[model samples]
Target: MGAYMSEKKYTKDHEWVSIENEIATIGISNHAQESLGDIVFIELPSVGNSVKAKDEICVVESVKAASDIYAPIDGEIIEVNNNLENDAAIINQDAENDGWIFKMKISDSNQYSDLMSEDEYKQFLEQ
Candidate 1:
């Protein structure tokens, strides 16, 4: 597994969010990418799009299947990783870092508290 940031929070759907200065950087968890196999394409939301907690904000296509990537909190998208448009396999190489899908200005920081901690998420995966 790649190095994971201690501050990152994860969703049941296998996305991760790391917040700093009210901006949340979002990405699919390593588990998600591993389950999906070799990712071939990605459909990301445009910058400035409004997304609610649990909203489907993107899609990732892999050799195994296409999966919807959900928002972990309500927010306005501030940026997206355009690099994925050309080489989606970056997700397979490192889902936690360069594979990040987008960044958003969170609507409510409190929403982050509800997400699973790294340990909780690891336990969830074990279940």
Candidate 2:
């Protein structure tokens, strides 16, 4: 998480994604995790599951409550982080990296245009 990395970009509901390639890494944002508190369990969609933008694809349970995690864009889930089943707290440790719940094979990267960039999201948080 040095200069080459980032922990930004946010959805209206507080999910985030960082795309380094054709694949987009997806997860809940720090704000969402903080609100939920002390994650205890996570239910992620199976790899290869097809999900559309805004579709509910996962759930995270924390000391406070259980919450649904939505797909940030239309795509097929390429990978699910098995680490959460054993160590769900990893999401609290690093929501952007180890906490990433899934990797999506976006059907159309252009759809990302509707999401907020890091700068915009940061501004959103301030409001």
Per-model C-alpha lDDT, please? Answer: 0.92, 0.85
Instruction: List ranges where model 2 is wrong by over 4 Å.
Output: 1-8
lDDT of 1 by residue, 62-86 (tens): 9888899988999999999999999
**Candidate 2 structure, TM-score to reference:** 0.89
What's the true lDDT of residue 90 in model 2?
A: 96
Model 1 ranges off by over 4 Å: 1-6
lDDT of 1 at 8: 93
lDDT of 2 by residue, 23-106 (tens): 788999888888889999999888989999989888999998999988888988999899899999999999977899998888
C-alpha root-mean-square deviation, each candidate: 4.3, 3.5
